[model samples]
Target: MRRHARERPEAVALRFLADGEDVVTEWSYRQLIQRVSSISRRLAEAGARGERVILLYDSGPEYIAAFMGVLQAGGIAVPTYPPMGQRPLSRLIGIIQDAAPRFVLSTARTRDTQARRVAELSGHGALEWVASDELPTRESYEDVPVVQDQPLAMLQYTSGSTGSPKGVMVTHANLLSNCETIARWLGPSEGRRGGMWLPLFHDMGLLGGVMQPLYSGFPLLFMDPMYFIQRPVRWLRAISKHRLTLSGAPNFAYELCATQIPDDELQGLDLSCWSEAFCGAEPVRSETMQRFAARFAPYGFRAEALSPCYGLAEATLLVAGKPAGTRLRTFVSPRQEDGGEASPEAPRELVSSGRVVHAHRVRIIDPDTLAECPPGKVGEVWVHGPSVAMGYWGREEESRQTFQATLPDGPAGYLRTGDLGLLHEGELFISGRRKNVIIIAGRNHHAEDVEQTAEAAHAQVRKGGVAAFPVTAGNEERLVLLVELKPDGRRTEAEVAAVREGIIQAVVAAHGVRPHDIFFGSVGAISRTTSGKLQRQTTRQAYLGGVLPALKVAP
Candidate 1:
């Protein structure tokens, strides 16, 4: 990266728009190398080398500098997302405890908030909290490049299915390989102008927003994640204004922008330069992509710019992506793909996530036997490549399970992505997750299936009332359902009674299991992750908190 920066030192490395001014932050290869060297020396002098440093800062030039500084100093950089509120602060502290970092780096504005929380978690002794503003400025130093295969980066806790968050250990090689692969996939014809509003803590933000630009020497346009959430239109406006060539988001983001951005606001926005709009981190819905493209088409948004990619923190971001300048693909079936059903003729839908990016090898395999499934057959998706992480930090068991796999034809090794999908005609189509599958009496049913059924129960159910999760009782698995009542609806005994009955009957008929427990609540009471995935553990926690209203169940 330092080498690339040196070669293109005069290039606009980062473009940070602050307070309506386009601040073109140019870093000629020489300047970046100098900055990194100075920062690394400062970090080393601060007793930070060979230890992990927790970065509690927002996305900006300083954040990038500190990140590169950590790498240059041979320390692991664990960048965290800004705490949402008090609750999330506690969660962040828990993550800090798990990571056991030597120091916590933050700006003055964030110092108190971060220090107070770290103190609470560590009983005021676990780590030294250093404000980035307080770090002494060093005059100069020579650039020191660390070994490529060394563990130099740490992606701190992003919650997955399990409520407990663990840091993903990303080596320098893992990061550089993925970045180079993404650069190649984007091609030289398409100017690699990255435009993103994802939080820097996220893999997409750190790798795609920062490292990709650094490695490729491409210009990046970044904004606070809050800016995008508060006014999603700004994201599109930025892209249009900058004539950004590359951008991306999870599925919910596209939906948010499409729903939030008013038609009139989109009128004069010219988005013709927009290309390689990658989508991932959540289920890529074809309908959402179509709506976004159709709505922004008048403003020069091309359908071919949609890049529905697949990746995870374990892989250091990208695993597989649709080819550049192509629409995303989706395989649809009117009926569910049953386990026993053979050679099912389901209607295939081409939504195009773009072609696979670079040297990554992807395959669909039977979850239990690890046998390769034929193309178009729904099974677990597996990926193998240089981008795959060393493993979860200090989690040998999980690392073994997630990163070890045996192919029928060859040596025993591959990343077993718990995601369920199929490869059709050389393209990957993700269906859902394997762990999310609910099995009742030896029959497998996807959670979406039950959620859909509960939603269709009645008008009230459709509003917001349903969640089905697999619950294990002694050795048998059962489904536990929770439903939230309409906000304005009466919570009287009579109303609760009817609603409970309707939900039970609806779920039993649709999923063949009467929920072991049924709880009712007001609309919007159900908690969800920032990405819009239902927070089952949070809901369970709320239920345990005695906040949910109990309704009489039919015998």
Candidate 2:
């Protein structure tokens, strides 16, 4: 960092954009390192090395500087997305309780504005509040800075799309190694320029958006996530106007731009210069990739630019990435893995997530037998590499269960990704989560397959707003469906009943399994994690507890 500061003092290392075209803040390489050093000194004064510091911020350049400062000061940074509106964020609260941080770091504006809420949070006797901007900036170097085997660097909280979030412990070696791996795998951007609109609190956004630029010595443009959400076209505009060589988002973001943007809005756009548009963080739907590429083809987007990747917080962000310009590999699973009998219509389309990146070695193993699965067969995905995190903080048993697994004949321990996928021609194709597979009678169906089918059954149902899970009834697990109806205040009960029937019939026709019960709910009834993936099991809990509000299909 100091080397960059000296070599390229005035080069723009970071830029934060708010609204759309406005540049709210920016930091040069020298300025960024200076701020980091100053904050490091302040942190050293207040907290001991290896102590946990809770970071609460909506957005700002200070967030990035302070995040780096925590590591420089030998403190573990725990960045959290501060609640935006009225009702308290239960997820943030849960994380806070679990982290049990001694110091809470926030921007001065956040500290002043969220007075009452901040009071409620910091009222805990042992917790201390640390304002980022107010921290003293005396450049004091540590006697022993970053030993070969130092303590853990940060605790990244999982997105909790499936269950309660756990803190993935990331050591210094793990952090630096993953950043290097990302650079080597993806290659450096043109002029070392990149842009991202993903929320900084998420692992992808943090690593790829913020840390990657610093680690690789590049300029990064970041816009507020809300602005991008309000207008997905803004993302493409930023990439084009900036001539970014690298940028990415979750699969749903690409789908939004493909489906929601009108031709008029897309006019005069040029994305020819944007290369290596990495997409990951959730299931990379094949249709989404195709639609996005076709939609932007006239505007200079290339299919090879559609880099489909796979990763998780436990792996410190990236695991696999496709080579530039190589199209995704497609395969059809056998009828047994396809959830029904053998027939021409039984083949399900699955897309490859490219190949494993750097030193990461991925394998498919039978979940119960612990034996490696043959090629073209779907099974649990295991990863072994330097990028794998130390373990889940404070959850030793879970850490062991997830991060430590023996293949008997193969490697001693591998990270049980909990994801089901197949390896073909050295490329990885992720199917779905093992816990998320809805087994009905004898057939196994991925939740995504079921949910997409239900959403497609009716016009009134919102796209990407269906949750399918298995609920135990007596001794057997029965399929339960939750459909989010598009907001129509005056819609009659009969219409909802028709929609429910449509969903059930579609599932039966597609997968040959009828849901045990179908509940019609209003828009936004389905809960998503902080990173915006649907929480199926969480929704199931709400349904079983009799608290999930559902529209009456029949009056």
Candidate 3:
């Protein structure tokens, strides 16, 4: 990367906007190389060489500089978002303690708290902390290049939905391969500009916003993720203002932007330059994409710009994506019937995430036996390639289960993605999660199938009301449905009873899962991540917290 920057010193590498105005802060390839060198020397001076260094800062020029600096200084980088203040400062301290990082680099406002917490966790009198703003400069120093095959970076903590966050160790070769594959799939030409508001802590954000641009020698535009959540249209406006050729978000982001942005605001926006709009990180809803495109198409947004892709942190960000400049493909049922078997044809109900990226080996396997399933047969989706990460940092058991597997043709060695999906004519179609599946009466039931049924049963429960989780008591495995009522609308006991019955009946009819528990609570009671994924474990914890009320149902 340093060599590439040195070769193209005069090219613009990064662009950041502190304010909403058109004025921007730019960094040429040469300037970036110089800054990274200086920061790397400072890191070495702070005793951070060949050691793990944790970075806690918002998205900005300094954040990128610090990240590059850590790698350049022969140290591993563990980057995370700033504390949200919900959890005690001890959480961050515990992570630092577990990793035993040599030093912590953070913004000025968080330096004291971060240092104090680290001290408490380590029980040391003092700890090393550097405010990103106050780091010293370095006079020309030799660049220490790391081996691409060895671990180049470490992302502490998984998505945190399942259990304790595990640090995913990514190798330089893994990172570079994935970025190059993504750039190739997107066809990022010279002078191509990409805009992103996803947090750098996330794989998608870090790889797409930072590494991709650097590897492709294109300029990347960055903004705070919070700002995009608060005002999504601002993302589109930013693309228009910067003539951004590529941008993307999870499915919910597009839904929020479509639902929140007013028609008048949409009328004034220009999105002609937007060429590649990758959507992933969550289930890609056909309705969400169609509505978003329809609502914004008049503003010069092309339907061909929508690129639905799939990836994960374990793969160093990218794996499979739709080809650039192609309209998204949808698999629809050929029959006009409302609920029909999904076929490869472009039916009204079909939704496709486009074709797979180059060089990625994706196969849908039977979850129980690990045998390759034929096309259109839903099963666990497994991918094997150079993009796959080395393994979890300190978890051998989990690494073995997730990162090591036996294929029929090769010696057993592949990552068990744990995601359920199928392939049809070379396109991957995700179904649900293997862990989240609920088996009732020896029949397989998907949580999304039950949740969607519940949503359709009552308009009040339409998005906020339902959660389906599998539970085991003794020898029996049962499904549990937790529903939250609308906040402003007060429901009588009869209404509550009706909702409970409706949910149970809906689930049983749709997926043959007779939920053993139908728990109801207040609206906004269900916890979810920033991306709107239901925090089932958190809800289960809350249930165990003794906050839910019991309701009697007819026998």
Give the candidate number with the greatest lDDT. Answer: 2
Cα-based lDDT at residue 24, candidate 3: 79
Candidate 3: stretches off by over 4 Å: 20-23, 88-94, 121-127, 138-150, 161-163, 332-350, 436-518, 521-550, 553-555
Identify the superior model by lDDT, candidate 2 or candidate 3. Answer: 2
TM-score of each: 0.77, 0.78, 0.76
Model 2 / residue 538 / CA error / Å: 17
- Alpha-carbon local distance difference test for all models: 0.69, 0.77, 0.70
Model 3 — which ten-residue stretch has the worst lDDT?
336-345
User: How big is the positional error of residue 158 in model 1, measured in Å on the Cα after superposition?
Assistant: 2.8
lDDT of 2 by residue, 1-555 (tens): 666777878888988786666665778887787777777777778864678887788766888888888888888899886766422244465677777777777877776766466447535456677787886554433332542344698999865322244789988888888999888987755575789888787888998778888888888988878888789999998888888878988777888888889899887789998877888776676777888898899999998888888888889888888876787677776641321112232355677888898988999888877888899887888999998998998999988898988776777558988888889898898765666666443234668777878889999888787999876553234689988888777788888778888988887766657899988776667878899889876677678777888764435
What is the lDDT, from 0 to 100, of the residue 68 in candidate 2? 84
Provide the lDDT at 509 for model 2: 66
State the displacement of the C-alpha of residue 246, model 2, in Å, after optimal TM-score superposition.
Answer: 0.4
CA error at residue 151 for candidate 2, angstroms = 2.3
The weakest ten consecutive residues by lDDT in model 1 span 336-345
